[model samples]
Target: MAENASLLVELLTEELPPKALRQLGDAFAQGLVAELRAQGFASPDAPYTAYASPRRLAVLVKEVAAQAPDREIVVKGPSVKAGLDADGRPTPALLGFARKQGVAVEALERMQDGKHEVFAYRRSERGARLAEFLTGALEAALKRLPIPKMMRWGAGDAEFVRPVRGFVALHGEAVVPCSVLGLAAGRSTLGHRFLSTGPIELVRADDYEAVLEREGKVIASFERRLERIKQGLAAAAGDAQIAADEALYTEVTALVEWPAVYEGHFDAGFLEVPQECLMLTMRQNQKYFPLVGRDGRLLNRFLLVSNMQVDDPAEIVHGNERVLRARLSDAKFFYDQDRKQPLQSLVPQLAQVVYHNKLGSQLQRVERIEALASAIAGLLNADRSLAARAARLAKADLLTGMVGEFPELQGIMGQYYARHDGEPETVAAAIEAHYRPRFAGDALPGDAVGDSVALADKLDTLIGIWGIGLAPTGDKDPFALRRAALGVLRILVEHELPLDVVELLQAAHRQFPAGTLAEATVGEVHAFMLDRLRSYLRERGFKADEIEAVLAHQPTRIDDLVPRLEAVQRFRALPEADSLAAANKRIRNILKKAEVVERAPKAELMREAAEQALFDTLLSLGPQIENHMQDRRYTEALSTLAGARNAVDRFFDEVMVMTEDAAVRDNRLALLAALDRLMNRVADISRLAA
Candidate 1:
């Protein structure tokens, strides 16, 4: 093995896609380090740093060996008995094996086999050179990159995420000779495309980042570059708040080799439009960071991340402002044109929009949503009129010019247009809030009206799509059914709505035409919803076993899942939890063979002393637990059930459950079944046994 030293590898390329740049760089570094560890050239604990920029991807690892360590080689030959004759001399088998190994028969050693001795050869094998092995490793890593599209350039038959401009691989201070993607490894790489004086020379592996930052004028670390932009934004925005957008920040970091923050402004007339419209234009069109005042509203000023710095940035700021002016003008035009039509008037235009050929037009879907929303609102005891009205107008903005330009602003534009059309505040708020919690960890609907409308909107899509057998398969959820199911689950649980999942699903299905849904459609959708519920609970910090125990009973009211999970969590902490869990499992097994749970065990039939004692204790405990349970006191009920552990243990220990007498055996089985039923009312206790 060679001495350990720092290693650096950089692949200079054309500008990478900004959004996926960080992910690609991180994956490349991770794959490279993992291969090094598996090949015995780098320790798992070795420190490493990944460097990514708009123009290059690089990784630096500390304490990487130049070659893998040599290992002892063991080669097995034929069994000793098969290789030897009656005289214990080498036979043809041994001779052939020795010849294949380039050794004589006498040089082979014999060792005991399973039923006989086996001939084996042992020797030292030199480890492969890192320079040679890394060629394949680099190729494998490139092949495994998460590039959605690979492009080819200039007729070499090599393809990559982008065209490869330069490739450098260095171990310590020496260049590890290798070729990747048809480019030979070298120690020279270019600096900034516009600002560089000449090609930057990398003398040592450790000098890669320092040389790039100083001579190349590049902040090579993605994270450090992001921090620079954040600090720069704060400095430029002063007391005003920059929009709290992590994704936007990360994207801008990937677009610049060196970052310079500058403040720009737009016409105060554009401020008449909604801030969402203006900010969306700023972010999506220009990648500019919009500033918000202390009142949580947008200021006229916006921050821009420049790739280069000049002593006089007047032209840069003026140029950005000029670009933003035309962008905002188009947005203002869309908003003004959208408001020219009443919100309700736009509803007819949706008829021309095809939602799904198998389902119906968008207008028909909206009608279903309106009906479902009113039903859900009635169940939730909210204003049904407002919910239906919100559902009616939710898709109206999809016809608007603003949404046509920026599809992400569909619900947001509906809210603006609804208010402009003089709709009720409740209805206007619901129009936008209905799409709340659009993604995981997002905020849910703002109130009961929003919740009702949101549920109806999601279920309309889910039932309509699933009825046609177009539900998500594998990762191909074109309809986002999983997201819809999770949204429904989050609404019910987070809002503490007392709606039953099955009833809601059945109600949603009823709005469809007769026979439009499969016979098992409701059941299938409910089960899928339950599956999502289990995962949602786990994400909220519940244990897997706790969630499984609660889900086993398949409670219809998802709002009650948390209470059951909490009770199970408390049950696990009890002193008798293990015994109760084991006992419940035993009771389940016994009852699995008998169906006499409803047949009351006759008091006179309990002949065994231990059985009578357990029966008497259950008489007092079951009713008390049932009383607390009727009041939804799950914790108290479970705590009360814990008191039955000693009686249960004694019953199993001293009583023969399968007495030969017919009446006694039936009564014993009945008693065990009754215990099992009471214990598992909140959750299937057997799952806790795991």
Candidate 2:
């Protein structure tokens, strides 16, 4: 056994990519700890802390051993029977193995390997010392980091995400003798770029963070720095809400070592532009957090996280304000120039913009979208003219200066520009909503008109992209066809629209040029959408079998999918559900094998008492199930079918349908066919069987 002590390792480097800082730190810490545990240098459950800043990556591990424990080593050789001949004399195989181990044949031990006794060499092996193994572990951990690109500094062979300036490797109160990235490990590390006076020395492995904060004027822990920034923002926000997302906060946290939040403001005139534009410039370009009033409007003031803290920070605040003014001025200029002309005038420019070489230009795609939107609007009983108008102008904003600068503002800028051209409210709203539900958990289109255009846009992309042999295959959907399919499914299922998905696909296919798409494209895309629907339903908490039950029928009208699934759930809970489902499964298997012609069950053919009784019960339940199904009362229909479980069970147990009489067998199969049809009207209950 070796003495154990805490360990610290840090890599001081140039400024890292802020967006990847957190992930880099986590990977560095976890990778080092994993290698340490694997090499027996640290315990399985050792406590550790990861420290990451813009200029450094570090980890502190507690209870790391200076050396691994010694253990026994075994090397298996020839089997006992082979190693010894009839007179128990050592054979050549055993002699060779013993010679390799540097021992005599009699020193070999015989042990059972599986069922056969084998001759083996056993010895005690010394454990490795930390100083001998630490560098290798560090190299392994660095090799596994998720660095997208590696750079070499000063023409050296060493390569890392950034130029490495220093390395720190400490065990307890002593510096470990190790080297990495062509740099020797030391106890000294630089802190803040401007605030700290000189290199900070760590006297012990445990004092890394404390000394960095107190003397070096830097916060080593990423999480602690983030919390401090959050507290400062909340205190400075007063009544205004901080209009920042987690991504912004994380990036800002990575940009600073000792974060100090400062308030800055822009001219009130910049607020005249859409708040989305202003907020995008501030957050995306400047890394600033904008403030929003209670009324959900952007305030002129914004908060910025700075690395330096001063008693009077007027210079920093004014400098940030000045920088933001230039960005806002650019946004305002784009907005002003974009509004000078109506959005419709830009539609013709889409002719030169290639959507895809296989699929026509943007102008042609817009034409297809326009026609499909009209057709979908007619199906939803929405304003067809409005849908068509919205679809025609949707891609027009792509040519605008505002949208060109901030591509995220494509649809949103279209809405503003549409309104400026005095377009109808419904048309403008539809133009924006056509791109709804862009990502998971986003909102769907607001109205039927919007839904119509959205479906058209997504359907065109899915059918067109898929028709050209670019369907999503093993996570290689460069065109995001999977997302488009999900968007279409969400619109239909969530809105409860009575549109047939296949019919919609056909309508979209018609808009394409003749002979451009394969004839089977419609059916293929429909099947793909159903696969996406299964995943979507599973995420909504439906059981796999339950989803299969509803989808087994391959229902083309998917708006009723949820209702059918809900009914199946209720049916599954019935006291007789298990036996009934088992019977249905048995029936399906029997019918699959039976060779019979179409015919109703003849009264005279049903000879057994149990068979006749089941026939009567099915007849009585037929009208009730039909009425429930017709009224869309799927739960009631399944409940009504459950009433025949006793008859079904009795028939299966007593009936023998494969008789010498062919007519009787065919008639019995027909009876079962009717029963199967009624039972599966809502869903294939057989899938629920255990």
Candidate 2 positional error at 113, Å: 3.9
User: What lDDT tens digits, residue by residue, belong to model 2 across residues 502-547?
Assistant: 9999999999989888889999999999999999999999999999
- Per-residue C-alpha lDDT of model 1 across residues 1-690, encoded as one tens digit per residue: 237888789999999999998999999999898888888889989889999999999999899998888878889999987898999888998899999999998888888767777999989878778888888989888878899888899989999988999999989888889999999889999888777788988999999999998999888999999999999999999999997589999999999998999889888889999999899989988999999999999999999999987788899999999999999999999988888999899898889999988777899899999999998999889999999999999999998899999999989889989998899988999999888778878999888999999999988877878888987888899989999999998999989999998888888888888887777888889999888887888788999888989888768999888988899899999989999999999888887876564777779998888888888888989999889888889999899999998999999999988888988899999888788888888899888885
Ten contiguous residues minimizing lDDT sum, candidate 1: 593-602
Model 2 C-alpha lDDT versus the unseen true structure: 0.93
Cα-based lDDT at residue 480, candidate 1: 91
Inter-residue clash pairs, candidate 2: none
Residue 325 in model 2: shift from native, Å? Answer: 0.6
Q: What TM-score would every model get versus the actual structure?
A: 0.94, 0.96
Residue 605 CA displacement from its true place in model 1, Å = 1.6
Tell me how far the alpha carbon of residue 518 in candidate 2 is from the true structure, in angstroms, after superposition. 3.6
Model 2: lDDT of residue 620:
99
